[model samples]
Target: MHMISALLFGAPDAHGSRRRADLVQDLLWAHSDPEDAVQHIRVRPHPVGLEAVLLLGGRADGAATAVVALLGRSAAPLSRQGYTALPPGAPVQPPVPSGPGD
Candidate 1:
């Protein structure tokens, strides 16, 4: 499984509560594949903040890639808040590439 996080910006549109709900639904649909089985999807809203955390099992890379695509499509400015693996650790350093002198 993999987890993806994103921060949604901008104010609610007409219809108030319904607008926010529709936006959230659209975001989820945009980020998820109908065929794929999603393990968990969570949406949290604050007075001035909207956060979404998606837990996807199976081939999670697809879901992660979809999120990047959806963020690009969204009219509202969405920023990638942060990300972490299951162990909740920093990234590993790749082996240094050998120069001309080996």
Candidate 2:
């Protein structure tokens, strides 16, 4: 159960960037898996009106896949936040095996 967390900061354009980011964040949270995948996510406006913060937590691999899916479905370009890879400080959890215990 690898875990990853990311913080996406919006660009300088207040209206477009903030709106797009908010929409993306909402969609991401809506589609997130609270049990096996993303446990939680937080989105808020930044001090700079043009910027925002997106905090997300989920399985590392799953998070990566979700991010890709989100980007693929998005009308706006998420590249402005330099989202080429996962953010720092993401924790990886050990996998849980399934089996019948004696």
Candidate 3:
């Protein structure tokens, strides 16, 4: 499913990449406003390590960059149809079943 959010995350150590998503979320929430609920979170990957993509309840225009700065890590944007995030070792699920053709 497509998500509306700012994808800004950093690399993780090879040993614990699977759990990095939760860690990134914690850091974001810790620095973000209490009301800006994180609607979506995807644990993807990076050349260096794992990363996270977050769709907040409110506008996430600058949140990604901010997080990058706050965390002192590099950041990148998630395009509408470009980069994708898939958890390591996760099985590729089949696409959602569509309705019968007319």
Q: In TM-score terms, which candidate is top? A: 1
- Could you give candidate 3's per-residue lDDT for residues 29-93 as a string of tens digits? 55444444545655554554445565555455544444344333221222122333333223544
lDDT of 2 by residue, 1-102 (tens): 333444444333555665655655675565444443444444444432222223335545565665445434432444444322223344422224358982
State residue 7's C-alpha deviation in candidate 2, in Å. 2.1
Off by over 4 Å in 2: 1-5, 37-40, 46-86, 90-102
lDDT winner: 1
Q: Write the per-residue lDDT of candidate 1 for residues 1-102, one digit (tens) a residue.
A: 888765554343434544454557556666555544556666665333455566666676576665555545543423232211111122333224469977
Q: Local error of candidate 1 at 100, Å?
A: 55
Assess the local accuracy of residue 90 in candidate 1 as a C-alpha lDDT between 0 and 100.
Answer: 21
Candidate 3 positional error at 24, Å:
2.1
TM-score of each: 0.45, 0.35, 0.38
Q: Is candidate 2 or candidate 3 better by TM-score?
A: 3
The clash count for each model shown is: 0, 1, 0
